[model samples]
Target: MKALLLVVLAALPVSAKLVSREQRLDLVRRARLRQAVDPSTMDLLNGPQGDGSFKVGEAVSCKYEEKDPLHPLGGHSPKFPCWTKSGERLKVKYKGEANPEVYGEVAGSRLLWALGFYSERMYSVKIVCENCPADPWTSTKESPRAVRTFEPATVQRRLKGTEVSEVEGEGWKFSELDHVNPAKGGATQAEADALRLLAVFMNHGDNTANQQALTCLEGDPDCKAPVMYVTDIGGVFGGKGYFTSYRHWTKKKSLWKDAGNCVADYKTTDEKSNDPEISEAGRKLLADLLGKLSEKQVRDLFLGARFDDLSKRQPPFIWPDGKSRPLTVDDWVKAFLEKRAQVASARCPR
Candidate 1:
């Protein structure tokens, strides 16, 4: 029976549609689904996603494939760009101390989901790559790239429901967001502003046009209106300067540029985030989403992202008294709540 099932699955045609930004935008314009900001689903928080585990067999196995220079994976770390055994494709993000993108991306993406935003379904796992190299990152210029025995390393499966535009950097910019910000059917200005507030709160570093996506949930047959989301948020939490600047993370909590005008201070000042024009509803949304997280959830978020430990390569720091203090999951939880309060409490004076 299992053999027959495998055969049937292998014969099935691909169901996903990789459309252009314009095409996806048109779908949103004519979307049938309610895209309202104040939907019934907004009433609850989704998750802090636990320990980031995946059961056996569910783990995706990928053989090394060419890295699309136009859309490369593993910004600083080693990545296995390959097709999986499940007849689907995804990039496997490997973890390392020198490459803090692994941890930041995991925690950042999870935070997006918890706040009711559509995001990449990244899960932590351990697996061996078939016919791989010791350093999977070597370009084609290197010789004998194929090796049979590769150690089982921690990799996060970047699930796709998220479609890419063939034209590089062809994503929705913050300025051109009126169509999808409050999208056409549902999302409101307040809701849109709240999302902007979110990016600032995290000090999102990769605030580029290409890092966002317009995607329908993976199995949606009737996806007239796909939700637009930030596809890459791995550059969050540690600020734009360093990948895991726990000190920077803890220090930067102020989120408002002008409380009276409802303006937010996006750490990276650009047209995409300047003067967000926040509203009361936006503040409430932040409060509603973040206020619901318990101490356990907050701790789990950072710990699961492997933020509990200190990186020796990131180098240690000393206090005025000459005492070294390691950044803990506890430090992150405190910073998260502090920033949450700053935004949630942001008042637009009448």
Candidate 2:
């Protein structure tokens, strides 16, 4: 019976789509207020470890793949691009770091779901073994484009602005998804605002096209409006120096006044501004969703990232303390909860 079921499932069409920025914007434009964001876009988030179990698979085998020179996914960390298989299948980057990238992937996806935005379904898995198959899929590289990078001078100019919200250095530039394809593709004001809010929440500095996707319908590449997914989400909870800043955004005063105006400099500077990105309803929804997380859920988020007893294991990055030792799980959770409280306070009804 199990074999029969497996065969039946295999026969069924696989409608998985990698949603892109352009496609997401189009959906937002057509959607009603707070209705632009689709929950089903990241169906994988509802998997076995959505609560934050750091197990990608048991007895995993990683097949090494080629790295793209033009559009590299792993910035500084040595990227061992490989095909991962345990129960679920994924093309993963085996980046064994002092702080693994899986933590960021888990955190970003979790928050995106809580905040009610389309996100990628990612997991932090342990690779027990490696078996590099001769043929492995790698990301294709496009022709070189003179993409702008934020210089030090630009950061200074941005900091001088009236609004406190600002993206750090080069690589943190806002995605040109809308600008490049305004007529056919582009986000609604609300969707754009939500993106900015998400960036602030995750301390997301990487706004490049690679970080996002516009997946097509089931087996249909022609379906451009299928779904959207934020691909490069593991670059959060860090600094704002690069597109994937390792900075964290825990302080309330450091962020925008509200989720609606996260992109401070661009809000007033850009003439193409439209409606607010995140609506009151949206904020309340996010607050409610985040508020509903149980203690287990919260703990699981960090635990899945392998955050636990400091004595037993140290954290990845050391920001607010010793340059050598990593932060404690307790401290990390506390800071996260503090930020969550701030989010609820500002957005939720008093």
TM-score for each model? 0.74, 0.55
Q: Residue by residue across 84-200, what tens digits does model 1's lDDT show?
A: 566544456664555666667767776776666766655444445566666667655354555343222334433334343434335556654556443356466566666777777
Q: Which candidate is the best by lDDT?
A: 1
Q: Which stretches of candidate 2 lie over 4 Å from their true place?
A: 1-57, 63-76, 83-90, 98-100, 114-116, 131-195, 219-225, 242-247, 251-253, 257-278, 308-326, 347-350
lDDT of 2 by residue, 1-350 (tens): 00111111111123222234443345433322122333333232222332223343333444343455664553553333444344333344443333335455556665665445555445545553244432222223332322111100000000000100012111112443233232444335445445554455556544454455433334433433434446456666653432222223443334444444432322212233322244544345555556766655565666554444221333356654656555556666666676666556654221
Model 1 — which ten-residue stretch has the worst lDDT?
1-10
Candidate 1 matches the true fold with a TM-score of 0.74
Q: What is the lDDT of residue 239 in candidate 1?
A: 71
Q: How much lDDT does each candidate structure score? A: 0.57, 0.41
Q: Candidate 1 regions off by >4 Å?
A: 1-77, 82-90, 139-169, 181-183, 218-222, 309-313, 317-322
